[model samples]
Target: MAFTRRGILLGMGAAGGLIAAWALTPRQFAPPLHPGEGEYAFDAWLKIGKDGVVSVAVPDLEMGQGITTLIPQIVAMELGADWRQMAVEPAPVSGAYGNPVLAARWSQLWLPMLSGLADAPDGLLTRRMAENDAFVVTADGTSLAAHELAARAAAAGARAVLAQAAAAKWGVEWEECEAQDGFILHGRKRLPFAALLDAAADYSPPDPPVLRAMAPQERAADMPPGAQLHFVRLDLPSKVDGSHTFASDVRLPDMVHAAIRHGPIGAVRLGTFDAARAKGMPGFIKTVAGPHWLAAVADNWWSAEQALARIAPQFAVGDRADSKAIGAALRKALRSGAADRVATVGDPDTWLKSKFDHVALYTIAPALHAGVETASATARFENGRLELWAASQAPQALRLAAAAALDLAPGDVTFYPVAAGGSFDARLDSDHALEAALIAKDVGRPVQLTWSRWQEHLAGRPRAPSQAVLSARTAPDGSLVALGLRLAMPSSTRELGGRLFDQRSGKDALFLQSSSDRLAGEGLIPPYGIANLKIEHVPVEIGLPTTRMRGNSHAIGAFLVETFIDELAQRARREPLSYRMTMLAGDQRLAACLQRAATLAQWGGGGAGSGQGLACWKMQLDDRIGRIAVVASARRDDRGLRVDTLTAVVDIGRIVNVDIARQQIEGGLLFGMGLASGSSTSYAGGLPTTSRLGMLGLPQLADCPEVLVDFIEAGGEPFDPGELGAVVAPPAIANALFSAGSVRLHHLPLTAEQA
Candidate 1:
């Protein structure tokens, strides 16, 4: 019989406190099996119990991507273990679990930039790079590849360790035994892994274990036979049964409730009213204030919120307060800013001057993550031992930040992972976690900090608004000639106050004290072999608080680039699909994806009054690159353009779970469509007015059309299926509108008036 241990479920009253202490404490936080107590340990990730149960811990957060299920599924496949007998949980914060892909990328980019290490020998620099292993996690859906590799390696290591233990127990040569499905096999008989558990006490793992290779025969044998055998979503049953634990479900003994009422984003401190009246409110506890924000703690959340409503705070406004002026500034910068050229193959100045081919300029407004669950955290500071339970995508980063805020060593802090309803970039900037820590430290008790919807809207960093001006020249014979694109946007790394080293002064400084220009553009520029091509970025500093969104810079840039490509095809009187195929000369992967989508959607053969449009995007995130294409069908009339159907084709290299991959594509498409057609968030007086759901005009069930997704398995390596839909949906919608005889959409959030 298979047995599973459920976590603590906090209900109410004194009994709940006792349950929390018994089941949710860190003493129970270790892996289900103890290393030295009748268990075989295989590194930090895998532990096999004497009872024949296998438990694995993964570092990836479970934010509805089904990572908890996927990680174990990968390990079980490699270990030849019974899937039904495995248990998985979140791993503790440690360097051993760091994502290799992210670590490699970060080391390559920032290691040599150190002041004293800039001139270091290549071998020493390489050694230093290998020592750093802190991987930054964001909700942008790019960590899948690295996590897959890491999980597989961990499983392989466990298999090797088990082989060694089995050899010793049977008194045979190591090569004389083969382990499969939790059993060690000798010539004609097999011994259960549990029988040799005691021998594992003296087993020492090999220096470098060989990982199973991805040969063609191995690939065919490993194909998941059904959903049950695949990387199935394991959290679904608990969620459906209403037994799953979210961050808000956590409760501790004598924990007070906290509510924060902070100034708007980028707002400077000015003044606040006296808290004398709030102190008199029912269930009032105490008030905590930071440099630019204040919080109230009470016996209940309602009392804390009620206490906050009685006070009025004032602050100095920021520079991007005027919505109209910010738009004007973006347009002006795109038109006249001195360009910092990124790539140029030949002289495009002379070609553009002599040709009257085609030019399109587009701009996108700012957008919010707009998560269902508002940001919240629970923290406690007791005698220099700080503990926090946060819905953080990057828990280690949050732990480090909290340690820094409390003037405590990192070892003094422990972060407990919790489930989040959603997190595009909300968890990336851990302001709420920091605030909770500070408030708990001051009050000398545990505090659960929550952000009101209004506060979440005002204080949260938004996707940076962007603008682009693309110009192209074509021959009269419909042949390509030259292309030029100038992209401009606020630097996200700089705006978020990233740490940097000043080369001139030999000192470290934040982005505020250094240049804002960055080489990090989100989407891969087009790979077409166009003559006289010039692509550049004009970095601008708009005094607005900005962070990465779902697609980051790629969403806006892809919108402009894809839409312009469609316009060029129209000007040349050629079919959009055919034009793209010609341009994708050597990119077989992208071409195949585009062709597959077109075939699935029946491109150029839509019924009367129905028009079709196609768009494709190639994304390079970390060490993985994948391509996605979308073909849309729509109709235009007095009711405006309505997208009736959408078909998407993806080449993500390798797929672990087809169901989960399809779901990600569907969700991302819906999210992008909501931003493209309905959203209208504006800023005024240094504050966003769309604080609630109704005002944001997000897309509803009625706005959704039929969506079909297809995946192409190239089968070598796997990339994430998270952000491709976000990159392909917006431009596909815009191109569909044009194909259906609507006016060109040069701006995002295609309003009815514009149509």
Candidate 2:
């Protein structure tokens, strides 16, 4: 691949010459995993103990996604180890665990102009950059895509050596030995793995270790409800027993608790605070002031919080962000802002120049993550080195950010990864980590900083608000001929990239937001076999900063496209399912999902008063495609909109762990239901009107709709199922509402405009 001159210049501008040179150069680093006294390291992904225990190194953060169990299961299956003897440890930042898949997907953010040249997982530039930066970020559902094959390979090598040891003892060729259930078998003889550990450590694995005929898979039919699980989740027991260590659960000797207060959005500065008011308060320690915020350190978290409240620091805002203003900005941009044509299929300009059969507009409010736990981190700064314990999607970036904030080398910061209570991609930012580091340094000891609920809303970045207008031209048969979509939203993805990769402030990132970002327009291209289609993006700069949410742009794009297609079906007086099926001739997997979902949901043709709606989506990253179809049953009543059931059929190619995949899809559906019904807030005076989690209108247990999910068995690469349900639920619910009551709600948090 050739790098463009413009791309090179942009890379140099964003990352200095030294950084750019390092990114392009191939370098090696020590393995991230270290074995214990009785353990033998097998490459970087796994270690085997003398007692026959297999410890897997997980490079991704575990936020209730079962990745800790999933990765370890992969190793156990490949190495022929028993599930009971499997273990997991968080891998440290190192070149050995680099995630080239994520690096290539985020090339535009890190490499800018050279993104096109390095946009493949196997691209030389992508690998070099990811390895050099130790960029093993846990986002975009790329964990399996990045680590699966490598991890399997390592486990296979380990299996080969173990077999060689057992073969020598049995006086037979290693090739004739079979490993099963943590034991090596030859004819009627069997030897446990523990008996061969010493000898296995000394044997050399084959150049290309032999692999099993098939990858690990669990059929949905075999794992019926209440059936015995083939591979139980490793973290479930600890989590249920309250022993799992989350960020807030970390404790250190002599650790002081700190509560922070951040200024409202826009240009702001710390004004005044009556610290004297907290002087007599019990357990109140000194107050630390930053450029734009204040922190109170005390013996306990509650005391620190009370002290901050008593101090009541004030801030002077320069350009406050308001919900009304944000909405107006999106509208203005959609109406007259300069547009960048991001994607095109054929001659859409000529086809769309004339009259169109149908046109519809959609709007989405700023959505909050509303994670169970707010931003929290424990940091210790001593002996000119900093130690941080936090749950971060981008660990390397967080380490670099803390290092830069403290004016220390990257090596000086030691980052300890911890489980997040719940992230939903909200842990991608390291603002809280940096703040904790600053407070720890200021207090000259270990400090745990926990943002109050109000502070979390004030400091946390929400998903970008958006507006889109979709127009379609139909043929004589009422099939789509040409389609055009104009979306107006901030270059939120680019802004997030700037903050994550370039360590730019939110303000600086907005100022440097690019005119066009392919990531921002992700999923805008319709998956249908449309002949002429054009997608354009109009970048708007709302004063409020926005970060990535669970589904990224797909959440918004799928809502827009799917709903618009539903409307077109209604306009043409056609059946919604068949209409979509007619257009999905090129994607059989997606068509199969739709058929399965409709059958599972007992879809009633989505007719008037049927309370049924259907939506489908396909997420493509390189050659991997995760497809899903949702059939939502909903209705409006005196109380409010009530969703009764959500049935989904997913085709993620192969199933690694059926139980985990089902849990993810179910969790994502509920999460999306929360976003569709609530999880939105209005801003006034630069402060969010909704502060507490309860105010976010999140669905409680009673509000959760019954969910049904079925997986389609297909032969291909496995895809992550984490974000598929999230991308399809909103549109399906909206279409259902239309079918039930002829109520066409265009905005997210469907009640945003209605309320």
Candidate 3:
């Protein structure tokens, strides 16, 4: 959910996206506050009960991403509790608990407004796109500010909880006793959390709690030995036992179910449909209709679904609905030279005027998240305050959107993050959450709204299709002289509200003047030392809505950039691995990872039908660097190319939980394997053309290659490991395809015919 580069651009920070603007603004650090309590509340995240149970309110929703467990581990590790004593629940949506890393970058985007230049066109555009500080839990991976904020908050809460317990037990100074192992130790006496809870009920902690180390460390002579750096996931037992309450499981008194049948994105409704047929169905209560929206409310989910199925909703299809036509438009836009320049170095225009050694135009098909779980939200609006429960990565965004729909302040709504069946990027701005809020408000009852798999597929924002024309010019000595990249794609940066531009009000007016080139060209620029480089983006507005996909344009952009670099090596008659090493001369971290991956995969050892390919990249997230390298081995046959093995070496700075990091790498690699091999989307008549699961061509476990993941710490604080494997997988696989055979693929999915 936090992983969309807006797709392909997921983890790649705007290399030079807004460096000048960022430099102009001072960094803002809005730390969260500690909430005092009744009901055992210690802060916005952690709580302790008289029974000695520790509950942590995680801001991010768990979608089988292990975050539910990861968060509990973080809280318990600092709070000195046994695994059995720890519990995790959803935190209220608020900017106070927003992900710092995402907040930092998002704040940069609003520099024009932050600098008080709102009257200017640039400032106005930025202001419109970034109207509210919508707290997002998905950005910065799990290691960045999102998880960092949660961990720090938990540590602080633990210190306070322990301090208060110590003060209450022996009537001693809070600082006199140290806490560990679920007990407050003062001299030779110990007070358990259960016994201290009563006296500490009204205790107020210091502004910031004096926290202890989470992982094992050498402690002062006065304190107990720190805990070990391992955790037994807390949610696993509940998940296995079916005791976990997912969003779909939420049930309130008199709660009714609502099913949605939304029209295709960007389509216009020509007329309204009569609900007579649907109303006749059993359990049918009411029908709601809006522009490009339709919903049926009934006693049960099945009946609501059936009711929707019976009604036929229609929309006037737009011209941009055709996939082939959209692709053609993108290509045309790329050739037009009317675009925005994202990154520029040296004199690329002068170099482009001279001779070029290699040139290629690569295209990638639009892809889908196609997660196992469909989008769902449950809402109950009683009185003025509205409550929403949803599988959202950005709960604050849902609150703001819902509040806007109801014309209320953000404080009027309270959002609870729920367990998602699966949320890739689908929960960024859940339409269902808004729909549920509206339905519940209108019906004057609690309502749970869910989208059918088919409707979800058709209405979901897909990864935008992309085309890049890359040209490289080499000097007489074979050193690269100039590298130029011209990319064309629909705007992925503009949020949901940007779509409805009301010029009269001048609220969304910036949508008309702005180009979403910033998001479209994210990670498209190279981090390597290319003396003369030019990266430009042609913003083509395809009518279809696009959201962040994992690796957001970076996956496809990396595929194009890495494969093209390989092509340049082939043109120069130099080995691909050697060429990459030469290009990455000064970057020791990336170089080390690359060399390690090559050594592990036994690069250049492939012979006959076997081929080994290598690709490496540096992901810049704000000030941090996430370096990764991958080597893929494959065999080509008449049927297609079979990926035999993939060896990856990653340097995400320090390691937090090795198990979770390893899982992220392996899972990310498998996800990339699916995108590189298949799992693409097509469109027609303003809707997804491919509806069935079989047509999508997702890679199963059988399709996953044997992946060997290795971690290489560069000796720094812990960094983000969320999108490392996902970002590196596609390009490495593409490079492997090139090595496997003379047939080079310039498009995605490396179809059977292409293979």
Query: Could you list the CA RMSD of all candidates, in the order they appear?
Result: 7.6, 5.8, 8.4
Q: Pick the candidate with the highest TM-score.
A: 2
Sort all candidates by lDDT, best to worst. Answer: 2, 1, 3
Per-residue error at 591 for model 1, in Å?
Answer: 1.0
TM-score of 3: 0.84
Per-residue lDDT tens digits for candidate 2, residues 50-76, read 788888999999999999999999888
Q: Which of the numbered candidates is closest to the native, going by highest lDDT? A: 2
Of the two candidates 1 and 2, the one with more favorable TM-score, higher being better, is 2
Per residue, candidate 1 scores C-alpha lDDT tens digits across 1-755 of 01111232211122111011112111232222235455555544666778877777767777777777767777777776776678776776754444444433333234435524422212334223322324435344545555554455556655655677777766787656666677778776677767765554445444344456641111313442233444446778788897777776679998999998776654356456578878678998888888778898898988999888886555554543546766776777788876666677677888876665788777777888888778889999998989998887777667777888899998899988877777766676778888999999999989999888888887777777777878888888565678888877766644443521111110122233123244335452675667777776766656566666777666776787888888888777777778888978878888999999988888873222446777898886544567899998766556444778889988876676667777888888888887777554678867886878666767678768799888777764566777778878888988887767677888887776654
| Candidate scoring better on lDDT of 1 and 2 | 2
Off by over 4 Å in 2: 1-28, 752-755
Which 10 successive residues of model 3 have the least lDDT summed? 4-13
Model 1 per-residue lDDT at 200: 48
Ranking by TM-score: 2, 1, 3
Worst 10 residues of 2 by lDDT: 4-13
Question: Judged by lDDT against the true structure, how good is candidate 1?
Answer: 0.68
